[model samples]
Target: MTAFPLLDPALCFVILTTAVLAVAIRTVFAAVVSFIVFGLLMAIAWVRLGAVDVALTEAAIGAGLTGVLLLSTVARIAKHRADRGDDVPILEGPEPDPAPTDPLPGLATQSLAIVLSAAVAAALVAAVALLPVPAPGLVAEVGSRLSETGVESPVTAVLLAYRGYDTLLEIVVLLFALLGVWSLTADARWGGQPGLRHLARPDGVMAYLGRLLPPIGLLVGVYLFWIGGYRPGGAFQAGTVLAAVWLLAVMAGLVPIPKVSGIRLRLALVIGPAVFLAIGLAGYPLHGAFLGYPPAIAKVLIILIEAGLTISIATILGLLVAGAPEERPS
Candidate 1:
């Protein structure tokens, strides 16, 4: 019998190599960079798999913002080490000596991990290979009912109409996660400035780039949101772009961070989820089901929700990367 077709040769090689480097690299900095590279590559894989939404998400959040966050943390950790007199630029744990440890994973643990990984991979391959040709799916169902949601994009229609609860819970989960991050703050630092205070030179490349990038990024992000009503982009993906721009400016010291306890900041944080819940509640009285909207205004309501979610998501993502506050609660 003929063997099933193999995975893409070049993509497979790169993914495997990156996967190894991400885990096997000795330095934390190298590992993080490797992981970021891996995430970008995975985004490409998602594109190849015909998932534009997943691809956008993977690139923006999984790769872009995550890389920034790790780099920021690594920089802080490195600075803390250097402040204690170590002159090396290499990344290790929070120690000054910087003595190197074993670069490889333990033999037993590595073996077990490899075995589990291979088993899962094989199972997935076999499942795909054995799937019936032209397997039944929800595509027709989605397409047929897309009109009911009053949205042009089937993905958007399903997300806001057929599965609105899932999206609502997702927003709540993000806010809750941020709350957990805040919980880690020292009591005195509650509501203080979040993340490290960057001090970029006035004429520095970072400062210039920070000033330059946000305008373009903001336009692109909003464009994504605007087009998402009938395209692959959406609030989450667009919000990630906006969040990244905010982070860039903050990291370059082109902007200041506000105290988390500020009423405006607090309001910004909660507005999206609050609006979403209110809309859902209104649905019961107006449309007879939670999260339901009048057929005539379904599209408009969805857009309104997306707009609010975009703002909230951008703030949340930026703050989450900024991590817990570190100064006095102002």
Candidate 2:
């Protein structure tokens, strides 16, 4: 019989605290910060569940990239309000009445939600608890075919070969999102620098750190991509790190954000998808199915595809963080 796992009391406490603060913090900025912490805690939980690939994704995209994106948006909001001569309010709902000062609005509604949440939690626990002693699994099959896929990592084999179609769609979706962000630029600000520009101040810690970090980050990012076929890293994780480095440079005002309309910038955003499509199309003549790699050069082709994807993913994510242009080009 399967045994129920004991909860880690410390992890549970941190998660609850961060989650409550994320919803309850009066200021939007504080709430967003709390939410970022919550994402990181969730990443830890994913790791504890023995899903290392999911954990990397949760850390790179969920916690790291998403946190930076939200923080940037928050800065934009604060700037927008401040520029309009508006006094920024804490902006919160009314405190719940301790005593029954009149009928408590939504009390029954809140109670129902709690009950529903508890029911869902109990159901999940029961399901896990009742899992078969020899749980059904597919690790053996994945391992057996891993060598044929020309990758040492079973996870990479699944992503690049078995589920290649799904990966292609995900890449295209990223491109579509990039197009949307670019479309939001004002006509005047079209092709202008993205996000806010920082003044050239070498004395600031941000600028100092920005200058210091990119080289190291770049090295690590490349290593992650290179080792992904045999290890825990991959295009998304590596690309996110590269994107973070680029964002840091832009945020520090050390480097200007590229214009949306720049040819090179546009190419950076689309090249991966374009290359992927080209290879997939070639499969019709060279192989029986789409995205099939010639067995002899499968590893080579996979590496090439991942390289282009890393660049494009980095570009798309960086632009997402920068957001649409609000000001016209100088």
Candidate 3:
């Protein structure tokens, strides 16, 4: 009744070659594009391995969000360079001869890297293709134990129950990364260009698309979060989508940058990690373990943690995109 899918060795070769070439390229823009391609190929690889959740995550976060972040950083760096007069325009007079480039570090460095990468990849491939499957794989065991953990999917069970501490730490890592970026931004002035000017309401196709798209995006994002426990959808993906919606709203001039970052904003930003850590600590007293939600209420706790994480992540992303503090409108 069903047809089986065959693996294409040629496709695998092409993808791997492309990934290597992308890394080898010197240009930042080309490298970014190549990385996005690499992520896409990796998503395909995940699908081939029958990992739908990983594939979705790779597509959404790896390829989509990371690409946007890279482009944003590039634009910011370009602007900074222009402001500092680091880049000079070429004159239209006679074509000037190009300057000779200096040699990179050393041959040993490149050779060492190449050898190491080749050896590692070969070893991994050999292990996968040549080694026999273990009698009782850990994956099967975990899947079987999912019911005891109050999670339907093995992935969810592992993330929310068996290894929840790691997930909690990951959320903290996101928060820390956000804080680090904010700190590195320093006290520089944005010069009144809040980056929201381009999002102005205008009469044309742009306005029509803007009006039509955000509602649909919001709906999709909410749906993803609601179904995350049962499906591939999860807090990280939903938060990113919600952040996109918030950014779109700001760009459309529907929501201006709020200058009054009083108590509320701070609380929203911190509450997610705070509540998560508190629950983890509370678990130690109740269950003699950290971040171990009781089976009776584990599902609800997971949902609640995800909700907080989504809100915090979205808010941080929006603020980072806006280049807050310096550009906040009074």
* Count of clashing residue pairs in every prediction: 0, 0, 1
What's the distance in Å from true for residue 264, model 1? 1.2
Cα displacement (angstroms), candidate 3, residue 70, comes to 0.9
User: How does model 3 fare in lDDT?
Assistant: 0.72
Q: How close is every model to the real structure, measured as TM-score?
A: 0.85, 0.84, 0.80
lDDT of 1 at 192: 87
Candidate 1 lowest-lDDT run of ten: 89-98
TM-score of candidate 2 versus the correct structure, residues matched by position: 0.84
RMSD of each: 4.6, 4.4, 4.5
Summarize candidate 2's per-residue lDDT along 1-330 as a digit string, tens digits: 225345566778999999999898767778878898888888888877777878888888988888877877776766676688766532343323346576655988889999999999999999999999899888899998787878897888888778888889999999898779878877877888776566757789999999999999999999999998998888999999999999889888888788777899988888888888888888777787799888877888788888989999999998888788866777
With candidate 1 superimposed using the best TM-score fit, by how many Å does residue 113's alpha carbon deviate from the native? 9.0
RMSD of 1: 4.6
Which clashing pairs does model 1 show?
none
Instruction: Give residue 111's lDDT in candidate 3 (0 to 100).
Output: 97
Give a tens-digit lDDT track for model 3, residues 156-203: 677767788888888788777766655644355322223534546576
Better of 2 and 3 by lDDT: 2
